[model samples]
Target: MHSYAAVLRTPHALSTFGAALLGRLSYGTVSLSLALSAKNASGSLAVAGTALALFGATSVVLSPVRAALVDRYGPRRALVPMAVVYAALLTVFALVTRDHPGAGTSAVTLGALAVCAGACTPPLGPTMRTLWSQLMPDRRMLQRAYSLDGVAEELLLVAGPLLVGVLVAYAEPAAGVAVSAALVLVGTVALALSPVPFPVRRGSGRRGSARRERTTRTRPRGLMQPVLAAAGVGLCLGGLDLLAIAFTERQHQPGAVAWVLAALSAGSAVGGLTYGAVSWRSAARPRLALICAALGVALAAAGLAPNVYALGAAAAVAGLFVAPALTTAYLIADEAAAPDARTQAGAWVNTALNAGISGGTALVGVLVGTLPLFLCFVLVAVPALVCAAVTLHGENHRKRH
Candidate 1:
């Protein structure tokens, strides 16, 4: 087992990672803040929902495009402008709600700003993962870095909402958006100024030719295994929220839903840290398959719990695989991609994950009302299990080849 301290001890690692996390925290806050602010300003839940949907759609769907631009232009040249525009739009959105003061702001106006803001959102998470790869060339150390990064991100997402909750209690919801804007702008600037250099993918160069050359060496399917695994994980997690609520409501202990969800987060953090400390001989893709399989099995069985507490325990156990699966997917993508295309590769994995989250919610929403609860759990777990089987089959096929 390796000490995580060593990963942070790498030159500029702490400062760089901190900056990236700061920016990512904004992501956590923005959704809740935007939704609340839009609701308050427009005096309509529909407007707020539409605003959130628009923002999430643009941000999640266009992740790879933003990452590709960073790969082509490097972080400072690309990320700086993106952060600037994103922060500016967030500020504008914040102002709209602040100035409106329940005057019933137009849904179209809020939705438009949200779309624009999301479109300019920087690809901080993918960039940070790529940076970790650059900072720690050794795969083992890189694994630790990814683990630490993942754990911190999980915490930040939890904390960002809490921070917004506090802010909204004291000030307006728009204040949360304002704070998110500051966090991203400052963090992006610091990251851009960091001494660590991001290798830019050029149109014509040996560096640029690497990904082009890979077409002859590996198939597109071969490169996308990690992304598929990530998508499955996200899909399971997305379904979990609705599933947990349904379980809690059925048991007539709806308040326990928060604790159940919290258990999942706590389990993921512990699992991520533990997974990071170990030195594994198995390859990342195979590890990913097993991780997904374990999570699927756990979740499939989670539907049978007799009580809310038992269901929470099941959720915690299922959560154990979540971080390890994601960490391995990132490791695989980083290893598979050329230096120039690494960010985009990571972004593809990210895009798949977000899309899966959305799909999972929609899928579960439709099924939860129609099917039995256990059957719903089984259905949600299907994606992970199917993804695992595909990954293992692909691995074995390559071995046979």
Candidate 2:
């Protein structure tokens, strides 16, 4: 609490944090809003699913490129225009889909528009993270800030969907989509306008500096490890979500799916708060490996759960380790990446996570129809265990050097 207060007391910290949270909320709402709009327009769950999938695909593909731009040009110069364009694209998508329901050309246009919107969506999360590194030079305070951000994200995952549902139910699906766009525009622009100083790349202005820096740089070690581990975590989380739905449906308690999933997020929030509050004595890499192993064990327990109640409980336990592992991954990435490439490295973390989620969802979607759902949980566990092993191996290899 003191740490949070101190960080927020820094210049523009509070405003930047608030704006970034709002921007993230907009991001969290996008998939649900798009799906609801697509379903309303096309009158088919299949089309809606396809639209959401395409949006995720495009966003994942373009995230690194967007981050590199932020690193090269600074966030204010890069993000503002992207946010505006993204917002406009989203508005057009909403208006077109709502007014021309079931029109073939409209559907096709919506698909293309979603892809463009995704590509244009500003990299709010990564930018805020980089901002934290700038604002809070203290390693402990930085960890707390990252953990707080992660907790807020979990809350967004819960609240964003509920807000969209309320708007869709009480008003219209288009209203929800429009609100999402508005939030994105407002939050991202405010963040860009905040007084926080964006980190400028070292030697950015010197002629031929980029080539010199590239040539002089030693091969970065553990650069990909953190990213791969992050992806593994994402895979487990994606599978866990689908497993919750399948579990609840099998029990004929489909309504409980939200509660079950909430258990995981709630646990992660609690864990993040606790982890950030304490000062850990261990190295970040080893801690990451330990947490991943614990998470994997918890997930396996979830797989063996005999009932929905048991499954939710196990999931909550698994969630306890999620934020710690992720925070450590970010710490590792910060240490390993070149000074000029930090923002891009952070962006790669998001990219890997998104890719993992997409792959996990697709893989589980295929298996859920033909195999036991418990096996899906087992499948999720595999990635975490692999992440642990890889991290541990990396640590050992580094120690030998």
The candidate maximizing TM-score is 1
Model 1 spans > 4 angstroms off: 203-219
Candidate 2 lDDT (Cα, whole model)? 0.83
TM values, all candidates: 0.97, 0.94
Clashes of each: 0, 0
How close to the true structure is residue 319 of candidate 2, measured as C-alpha lDDT? 90
The stretch of ten residues in a row with the least summed lDDT in candidate 2 is 212-221
lDDT of 1 by residue, 1-401 (tens): 55888888899999999999988899889889999999999999998999999999999999999998998898999999999999999999999899576789988899899999999999999999988888998999999999999999999999989999999999999999999999999999888888887878766677647756774266356557999998998899999989999999999999999999999999999999999999999988888899999999999999899999899999999989999999999899888887877888889898998999999999999999999999999988999999899999989987899
Question: Cα deviation of 189 in candidate 1 (Å)?
Answer: 0.8
Ten contiguous residues with the weakest lDDT in model 1: 214-223
Q: After superposition, how far is residue 180 of candidate 2 from its true place, in Å?
A: 1.4
